[model samples]
Target: MSSPSDSTACDLYDADRPLNMRCACGRNHGRGAEIEVSPDDKLEASLMKALFPVDSVRRGFLRAVGANTARAAIASVLPLGTLQAMAQDKAPLEKTNLKIGFIPITCATPLIMAHPLGFYQKQGLNVEVVKTAGWALIRDKMLNKEYDATHFLSPMPLAISMGAGSNQVAMNVATIQNTNGQAITLANKHKDKRDPKMWKGMKFAVPFEYSMHNFLLRYYVAEAGLNPDTDIQIRVVPPPEMVANLRAGNIDGYLGPDPFNQRAVFEEIGFLHLLTRDLWNGHPCCAFGTSAEFIEKNPNTFAALVRSVLTASAMARDPKNRELVAKVIAPAQYLNQPETVISQVLTGKFADGLGNIRTVPDRADFDPIPWQSMAVWMLTQMKRWGYVKGDVNYRQIAEKVFLLTDAKKRMKELGQAAPEGAYPKFTIMGKVFDPAKPDDYVKSFAISKMA
Candidate 1:
């Protein structure tokens, strides 16, 4: 039995190749040329080339010092072995144990389910999906770095990055959590006042000032020919408290995340007045993101986290897994909502609180692609509503914050078809929004708060 070190030079070289082709160690080595060298292998080869400018010098030095001695010397001098190892598989992840924050909403389905479904564990990560009190708390904890990553309103990352609502700390939206899963749920008493014209002086609740729920509610009412600012009042209420507020008569209705919207119906307090999907079929509702600093420091860990969430997103996207997902995430450790209510939201077939069963399968969807156009749309809305002012570089900010490149790579890695084009046109309330002309889209809104 030949020892590893006693192997012939040709055999040693052949070991590195995919196929064992015995060839002289020369410039034109035989069939071994066809073998692909991995990144780590390339690193090692490059280092060897740099260390000895002449091939004869390298061979003589290796022959003199021996392979084991040469490896020890290289490792001691420059950490060549470590560098090669890192180049091979992403440096063993900068982090393994992580604390992620989330609100108990269906928008966080992928993130929440990742914990119970062992997706994080599969990625060699121990993730704690801490159920936060509300969106504001989630934002605060994320900003403080109390939680490594958190569920964000799709607009929140953009807002945070631009310093619109909080201190400008660069954030990145890794993937959209859910889309078209929100609804304008009104109190049962307001059933007679379905028209926005009759909603004058009505108090409404939104999860956050910088949330898609707020933007969608504003747009919906504005399209109904009512000024969202003065004609109706919009308060920032947590989703968990939406049903309670509605039942207490403190709020007339809320455009909130589920299963709160569906929970209201189950509790006999509110009716689903309108699904946000009716206004925009594929509107982004929430996002999974972390600070840009975190990603820079822990690229591998962040990639693993993205893979885990995207895997969960892929699972959540299938209609067949909706019931199972609802069951998996409806426990006290997760969403903490009734399984039936959560099932109704995830399954997309539920009582509208008006005694009729409504079926809209895409009512709550888990599309993880973080399209840049979606960010552009959010920016346009932000400009239209005066959340942002002055000349806005729509595409620049969209690309910076949305992480479209990262999303595309991860989606492709998971065998999902990545969406083409960063700026795809979308229609909101029948108005075409071309991302190329975001300023025009903002100007086209008649009932805007833009100065």
Candidate 2:
């Protein structure tokens, strides 16, 4: 076979013809056509058609300089060889059949929906999204490598990477699965005590210690001049059991993921005390991610996986698709909850359990962009709450753990505009969280567990 440098340059930049269309040379070509041809084939066809627009002149030129020289000339101009290699480059998947784990909550919508919607199959992947019991089990399975990827609490990856709750394993957050979808639910008895100051001495539940729920809950209570570690009793309870705990009065309230928060309101055991969105609007709740080793071992598979989830996230972001997404992921195979409960969480329209119907369309959103600032903030909280002990390299860990680059690329691939920047300033409860000065931010907190 003639080397790429030896091939002649073909004038294949046709403005009118579709990229995938067959050229006059009886070969398929196009600029953006959805043709089945490999990238190399497409490039070759386009080049041949362009170089020899008039078959007689092209034949004469090729006969003179030869095909190899022509290729070298073309390579010198457009780097067609490199482009063709990229187009045709299909990285063989290290593993195709994969098991991904996710909790049965609205926060895991993108990952769960990807399966039913055939997004995984579209990328030549066979993904089994196992409905995990809770966040702790999900973490365990991930560390054990029983699950290749998982629905993670946005902070879990950071904590896991640092060996906080599990052995130190480098993990990466592929995307923020859902944001601002969590709520602090209180037993109906505490409805009269609507203030956080009144929450002192009350027992509250969070899905995991290394969860956004925990951090946000602590921040919310601390901002009220109450110590999260001493003033309030915070317990690690699985989300599905939160409502039950509320019903049994096992816990006074919980800052947890949906549809459990909504489920509590549905069960009439608790009222929506406050949405986490109220504490920090647009806060990231959960993430879609896997271990760093997995990404390193299967780069293409991971890329395809990120693209599939990003596609699902793009669909889930649309309000028009929320109701449909609710139905699709509500079955026993996925969330295993009432469709109405899931719908309320996904659509952002639900009863506040006080007879008021609240409508906040962005109450829960699948933004998919894993902002590094989010990770930075989580680190600050981890430091604030004594999760990570000494001087923490906040930005380095944030960049290492959150796959912002991959998330942005996949978002763009799915026609979504990726948000710019590594660390964006966030206003949590009216206080600016400058990720640049996390230690200062931690020091600013009055009721932290920090000594």
Candidate 3:
């Protein structure tokens, strides 16, 4: 037997596990009845007691105003739904405050947009997306623990982990930030010399030594029968300065990230010679990652970060939503470019700076998967260029750094259609790259720095 005063009857009333002889409390002439007290009913009771404070007054007020009227009054003033959510979600975060670094490029679309849209807050994180000056600064900050995570040029983690261009620090790429969002832009002065073979004796710029921009530029020039080292000059320049440098005639052209590539076109200084997607249709350009040490210390925080970014990635993948996304990220605090320019870069329709409008929708895509094979391909380039010397255990390094399994798990949890397998073959410039035989692929390159 249970009375209305009993918490078991008032709060823990489960219909399947009903208490025998439950008091109806004046209902049906005081007969025992099967009753179910909901969470709302319990909340209403608590709120009523708080409002009245005296039992006699609470009973009198409820009797006069009625339960339905009381619930409406409580909900209007108190936002009971928010209270319920706060009560239900009590998972303590390992870290709530974090700083993420990024360059002012459209490649950082997902991570950058997550800030303004409250995705980080939704996961109980207070993330500050810091705008970095250059790739070297981004690497230095990450190494010194100044940034918890960063926007990495996709090959950066592989290079940094292998001690190629910097002191070795283990980094893990959580997601490929953007793919196919880069272009080979030449100054308008060299519009007649569009062919790569003619690009010999010309100075070129890349964002970093370990960037896909560098490798792709090297591959493109090599295919045209020119040694990238001897026949031409390649310099490392920050993405934001790429257009300004071109305008000042500091360099002939650059294979750089957008909205800078588009910025070059927008400013009328350079023309889009070719999109990198023309060289390798889906080549990865930028990535979002943190140190492996950070992941080990704050696994939950890292998972939340990935979720926040991936959610933005899923939203940005829709072509119709791109213009809206551009508006959100183009303000001073984020990418700091004109909305129209960012929209042009994101929406994939723009002027080529050569008197024509071009539309290539996958020109920029938010594919979050960091395939291990992508890591292996990057490694082969690193070896071929002598950035890494001798036999590389390609598989071991690829699996350790890329984190394909974790990405797929998080994507599936968010109901995004994630693919199976860690390795997928890609054809770059009509040559099929087999990730399984990385050594053979490295040797096959005709003008490799490899002995």
- TM-score (all chains, Cα) for each model: 0.80, 0.80, 0.81
Candidate 3, 1-451: lDDT as tens digits = 1233454444222222322222325222332343344333444443433344345555565568754564455455432343344334445679899999999999999999777655676667899999998999999999999999999999999989988888999999999999999999999999999788898799999999999999999999999999999999999999989888999999999999999988888888889999999999999999999999999999988888887788778877888778767867887877889888988888889999999998889999989999999999999998899898878999999999998899998787666789988889999999999999999998887897874
Error of 2 at 190 (Å): 0.9
Best by lDDT: 3
- Candidate 1 lDDT trough over 10 residues, lowest sum: 15-24
Tell me the tens digit of each residue's lDDT in model 2 across 309-417. 8777877788877776786787777878998998998888899999999999988998888899999999999998889999999999999999898788866755568
Question: How many clashes (backbone N, Cα, C below 3 Å) per candidate?
Answer: 0, 15, 0
Q: Give the winner by TM-score: 1 or 3.
A: 3
Residue 96, candidate 2: C-alpha displacement in angstroms: 0.7
lDDT of 1 by residue, 1-451 (tens): 1123544322222322232222223223544334333332343343344335355666676678776766655444332322223234444879998999998888999898777555675567888889889888998898999999989998999999999889999999999999899999999998899888899999999999999999999999998899999999999998888989999999999999898899999988889999999999999999999999999999989988997788778878988778867767877778888989999998988999888999899999999888899999999889899898889999999999999899889777666689787878898888888989888888777799973
For candidate 1, report its TM-score: 0.80
RMSD of 1: 16.1
